[model samples]
Structure formats: C-alpha cells, structure tokens
Target: MKPTSSLVWLRRDLRVFDHVALHQALQDSAVVHCVFVYDTTILDALPRRDRRVDFIHASIAEVAAELAELGGHLIVRHGDPATEIPALAAELGVGAVYCNHDYEPQALERDATVARTLRDAGRRFLSFKDQVIFEKSEVLSQTGGVFSVFTPYKNAWLKKLDADPSVLAPYHIEPHAARLAPPPSPAPALPTLAELGFEPSNLAELNIPTGMSGAARLFEDFLPRIAQYKDARDFPALKGPSYLSLHFRFGTLSVRHLVRTVRDVMARGAGGEGAPVWLAELIWREFYAMILFHNPHVVGGAFKPAYDAIQWETGPEADELFAAWCEGRTGYPLVDAAMAQLNQTGYMHNRLRMVTACFLIKDLGIDWRRGEAYFALHLNDFDLASNNGGWQWASSSGCDAQPYFRIFNPITQSQKFDASGKFIRRYLPQLKDLSDKEIHAPWLVPRMLPLDYPGPIVMHDEARKLTLERYEMVKKPGPSADQ
Candidate 1:
C-alpha cells in the first residue's frame, strides 16, 4: 500500500499545535509537508519598511524552527501562490494539499486560482474552517438569510456553541515519525527582506513579538485582567486591552481556544461584566469577518450604497484637514492623542478608535475611507474587515452603524474617558500641566500654558456645524430606509 502524501500550506494560522488543517493533514496522510509562501501579490504593494512584513518574516522563522525539530522542514517560497503551491506539490509528488480557510477578498481569489491549478494537475485541494468559530452562513437569522446586524447573530452563535461545544476541542498534532521525506536536492534559500526589496523595520522596538510563544505570553498576561476588561478596556490611561489583537490578526492565537476559554469563564459565572463584554468584542471580530465574507465590496466601497451619495471634502481643503488629523494637531486632545498613539505604537484603544474615526468623518468632514486607509497603513493589528467596519460604523455608513446625527462631541468624550488627562499627557507631553477640567478642551484655559503646544487646530463648534451641513446635503428630514 502506498502512503497518502499531503501538503499543508500555512497562511495566517501559523502555529503547529491546535491547528485544524495541520492536525488533519498529519492524521489523514502518511507524509505531511509544510510550506509558507511570501505572496508577491501582497508584498510588492507594501512599503519598503513595512512592519507587517517584518512580523511575518520573524513568525515564519519561528514556525520553520519548530517544524525542523519534529524531523520536518518548512519549504519557504516567494511568488504568486497559484504558481508556487502547484509547483511544489508536483516536486514533492503530493496527492493532496490542505489548508485553513481565509476570508479576505484577495485571499479568496488567490485560493481559487490555486485550486484551479491543483485540480488541473489531478491533485486534491482541501480547506477547512480553523480561524473563526462561526463563518459564512453558520449563524443565520430565523428566515435563513445572512445576518447584517450583530446582536441576533451573536445570540444565534451562543446558542449553536451551547448545543455543540466539542467544536472547540484542541487539535493536538501527532506527526508520523517516518512521514517527513528526505529534502529535495538544492533546497531554495528563504529569501531575505533585502532580497525582496524591503528594508529593515522597527518591529522589535514596538515590543510586538511574533509566533505562538509570543501569543502564549500575551494571553497569559491578559487572563488576570479578563475579569476587569469591561471597565478597564475603555480607559486609554490603563493597560487594559488584551494587546493580543496582533497575535490574533496573524493567526498566532487560535480563535477556538479563545472562544472556549471565554465561554468557560462565562458558564462558571466568574467573569461578571468583563466576560460578556469581552465576549461581545470577540463576537464583533467574528461579525466583521462575516461581513467581509458576505460583502467583499466593503473593502473599497461603502457597505450601504446610500453612503456613497455623501460627498466628502475635496481639493486643497481635504488635504489640509487630513494632514491635521494625521499630525496630531486636530485641536482635540483625545483625537490628537489617539492619532499619536496609532502613529507611535501602531495600536489604538477601541474607544479612541471610535472617537478619532468620528472626529475625522464628522468633525473634519473628511471621507471615512481616507481615515480607513491611514489606519490600514499604521495599525499593527489592522484587519481589513475590522478597520473597514469600524470606519464605516463611525461614519454612519455601515450596517447597524451609529446614527448620522448622533455625532460624538470630542470635548465631552475626553472629559468622560480621560478625566485626569493622563492619556493625553502621555502622548502630548507639552500639555502635562493642564488641569483635569481644562485638559479635555485646552483652548479654554488661561495664559498658564505650555510654550511648545499649539492652539486648537480647528474650532470644534465650527467644525461640527460644517459636518452637519455636509450631511444635510445628502439626507433630508426623514427616516433612513435601511433603518
């Protein structure tokens, strides 16, 4: 009898343990070969000193080392995945290729091409759900259609998990000893960042380590704070957010394991408000993923077409406003501080994300897509789905988005969230001496001020009036049809 040879192609899900596709390949086949392709399609479009690329490179190195210790080596390739996967499969004479499902628009298209190439070569192509607990149409409304809203989808998701909780079981990898074949002659060298026309980035300086080990460390550190997550997550002054989002984005952390842990705590009534709230955040993650899957158009366009009717600031004025927003000179301390946090650390708190996003689209009358793209360039944990969803949500253009007239008052926000101005002072050191009451709106303070600090970039009242006028141009005095 011949051994069933299969190739395990790794993408975002980079870990060896508790990986559904990897574990399945090891169990169902005799020899399981692992491979990671540095997709040229994505890399070529990125800037030379992209931190995401550096993060991926470091993560793959960790993965390769782990697999090498188990008597197998990861075959690294650089090119169009559609070409590389089939070429490697032929070289290894593998009967099938297995991988986890990816929901991004580009990934789906790339996978389709790879699937076609593999099928032409008479090889089996298999993909499994390993990332999200519920995907595609898994958790639907009673009428049997995809859910556009989150609450009902979440209720359905919880109900499904309660009925069949075994789906969250850990998939321990058991690689066969004799399965790893001898290396092919003249193995290709793993391409260096320089070779790929990418320069060195300050990924280490950001203190965001890559790989499963790093993910484990972060998750462990976050567990003690899980109980207080609901209260602490909103305040930027505190170290509250799990900070594991980057790990989750890159597939270093397993979604199934997270869901299980969170659910288990909730079941025991131990997590309190934190459990349900954090779980809601996770559901938001899943919801955004599902939204991306269902409406791939949201990647570049508005989720609701009516939003496209809303004209944005253009010409020189738009550029000026965008520049102000990006440079942390938007006059709003919380907004400025949030932008600075994103620019300096590549991470922004959830509350700040909402506040700044609203400030950009509503206060500045800028397009939500502009802010979305800026975030895409800077965020370390930037997922296209979540970023798009968040930007659209802030702009009142996405499904179940905030009401158009319910604009966020930046001054009020800073006062409520960062009462002592500690968060603002951390990022805007020049404003360190401001009183707690005056910190939210520093222009109102007296002459006792920092010499270096600039005055308010744009008057909040005028900006708010301009925003409402801009919105009125698109909408009349009537209820929105989508609502």
Candidate 2:
C-alpha cells in the first residue's frame, strides 16, 4: 500500500504549532511537505524598503529552519502562488494540498484559481479556519441574519464561545511531526530580502520580534501586564497594549492560544479585570473580519450607503490639507504627534488611530478612503478588514458607526486620553518645554510656540460647524448623491 502525500502551503499563518491545516494534513496523510510562497501578486505593489516584507522574510526563514529540524523542508518560492503552488504540488507528486483560509477578496480569487488548477490535475485543495475563532455566519443573530452592529455581535460571540470551549483548543504538531518530509533531492535555499528584489528595512532596528520565538517572547511579556490593559491602554505614553498585533497580522502567533490562555488566567482569578477588557478587544478583531466577509462593498464604498451623500473637500485646498494631515503638520499637537508616530515607526496607538482619523475626515473634511489608503501603505499591522472598519467608523459611514454629528475635538481628546502630553512630547519634541496644559493646544499660546511649529490649520469650533453642515446632506440625500 502506498502512503498518501500532501503539501502544506502557508500564507499569513506562519507558525508550525497550533496550526489548523498543518495538523489536519499530518493526521490525514502519511507524509506532509510544507511550502511558503512570497506571492508576487501581492509583493509587486509594495515598495523595496517595506518593513512588512522584511519582517515576513525573517519569519519565513525562521519557519523554514524550524521545519528542517523536524525533518521537513519548506520549499520557498518567489512567484505568484497561483502558479507556484500547483507547480510545486506536481513536482512533489502530492495527492492533496492543504492551507489555512485567507478572507481578503484578492486572496479568495487567487485561491479559487489555484483550486481549479489543482482539481484539474486530480489533487485535493483543502483550506481550514485558523485565524479567527468565529468566522462567516458562525455567530450570527437569533433570526439567522448577519450582525450590522458590534455590541450585539459581541454578545452573541461570547455566548457561542461560552457554549463550546473546545473551539479554543490548540492543534498539536510535535506528536505527528515525525511524518514531515524533506524536499525531494537537494533542498533549495530560502530567498534573501535582496534576492527577492527588496532592500534591507529597519525592522531589526525597530526591535520588533519576528517568527515563532518572537511571538512566544511577546506573549510571555504581555501576560503579567494583562491586568492593567483596560486602564492603561488609553494613554499613549504607558506600556499598555500587548503589542502583538503585528504577530497576529502575519500569523506568527495563534489568536486561539492567546484567548485560551487569557480565559484560563481569568478562570484562575489571576487575569484581573483587564483580562476581560483585552478579550473584548480580541473579539472586536473578529467583528471586523466578519463585517468585511459579509459586506465586501465596504472596501470601495461606504458601508451605510446613505452616508455616501455627504460631500467631502476636494480640489487644491483639500489636497494641501490632506498633505498637511499626512505629514503631521496639522498644527494640532495630538494629531500631529500621532501622525509622526505612524510616519516614523509604522505604528499608531489605538487611541491615536481614532483621533488622527477623525481629524482627517471630520476636521479637515477629507474623504476617509484617502486616510485608509495611507494607513494601508504605512501601518505595520495593516489588515484590510480592520483598517477599512476603523476609517469608516471615523467617517460615520460604517455599520453602527458613531453618529455623523459626533465629531472628535482634537484638543479635548488629547486632554482626556493623553492628559500630560507625555506622548505628544515624545514624538513632537519641539513642544517639550510647554506646560502639560499648553501642549494639548499650542496655538492658544502663539507667543510660546517655536518659530518652526505652525499654528492650528483649522479651528475646531469652526470645523465642527462646517462638519455638521456637511453631514446634513445625509439627512436629505442632496445633489451630492448624484455626483
């Protein structure tokens, strides 16, 4: 009797343990081969110095090395997966191909094409639910309808998880890893960042951990701090968040493992009040993923179609304001500092993401899509679903978004969340000497501002009034709807 051979292809899910498809492949097949393709379909659009590319390169290298030690070779390729995956499967003479599911529209299309090609050659193409605990219609409303609002969805999600804790179980690898197979003949070397047509980025200098070991280190560090997450996450200067989002985005860590550990900690009464709060945040990630899956139109248009009637600023002046907003020269200290953080480090704190997004959409009257595209290009943890959801939320155009009139005041948000301006000062050292109160609104004391720092580009009071007027069109679909 011949043993069944299968190929395990990797996408965002990079780790070898607690992996859905890998474990299933090992269980069903006698021999399993692993591969990671640096998909040219996606990478062709990215810049040469992208930290994301560098981070992924390092991660793939690590996974390949780890797999080799376990008696498997990760056949690395730098081409379109649609071609590379099928070609490799044929080369390895595998009976089936297995991988984790990808939800993005483009990824789905690519997967479909690959599935057809594999089926034509009489091979199985299998994908599994690995990233999210609940996906698609798993946590829908009682009436068998999709959830448009987050709170109700979150409630249902908790109910579903409480009903079945087995959803959080880890997919064991080491026990079955002896079935792993090295590449046929000689193993090809993993591609270097330079070899893949990318320049060396500052990922190492930024001190961002990469791969499985890095994820373990970050999770270990964040466990004790989970107790203070609820209270401390709002302040930018504090070490509050898990800072494991990048790992989540790239699948260096398992969200199921994180949630399970958090739950276990809470059950033992060692997780503190912050554990629940952090768990809620994790559910929010799932909520956004669910939204994107159900409402693909949100990618290009407003989720609430009626909000599309609201006109946005355009022409030369709007371009200037948008440029100013992007460069962190908006003359609002918190907004500017947040932009500076995003520009310099490819990271913007959660509180700051909202503040800066609101300033761009409401205060500057710019389209939220512009800001969304900017973040898509620059953010280290940029996920299509979450990024689109957040931008639309700020613009009051997403499902269950803030009311159109609920404009965020830059100064007030800064005073509330970043009270002492310690975070602002860290990014905008030009305003370091100002009193804590003064730093929140530097233009209030024009004489005190340095010659280099500019005054407020748009006054909050006046902008708020204009924003109200702009949003009035939503109440009555005006001519802007036709445009």
TM-score of each: 0.94, 0.96
What lDDT does the true structure give each of the candidates? 0.85, 0.90
Each prediction's number of clashing residue pairs: 0, 0
Q: Which of the numbered candidates is closest to the native, going by highest TM-score?
A: 2
What lDDT would candidate 1 get against the real structure? 0.85
Off by over 4 Å in 2: 1-3, 183-186, 446-448, 476-483
Residue-wise lDDT of candidate 2 within 1-483, one digit each (tens)?
Answer: 222999999998999989999999999899999999998988999989999998899899889888988888888888999999999999989999999988988889999999999999998899999999999889999999999998999999999999999999999998999899955676777888889999988888989899989999999999999999989998999999999999999999998999999999999999888999999988988999999998899988999998887789999999999999999998999999999999888899999999999899888999999999999999999999999999999888998887777778899889999898899999999999999989988888856678778899999888877887889867642332100
Question: What TM-score does candidate 1 reach?
Answer: 0.94
Query: Model 1: which residue pairs collide?
Result: none
What is the clash count of model 1?
0
Write the residue-wise lDDT of candidate 1 on 202-254 in tens digits.
Answer: 88887887888899888888877888998999999998888888888889889
- Pairs in steric clash, model 2: none
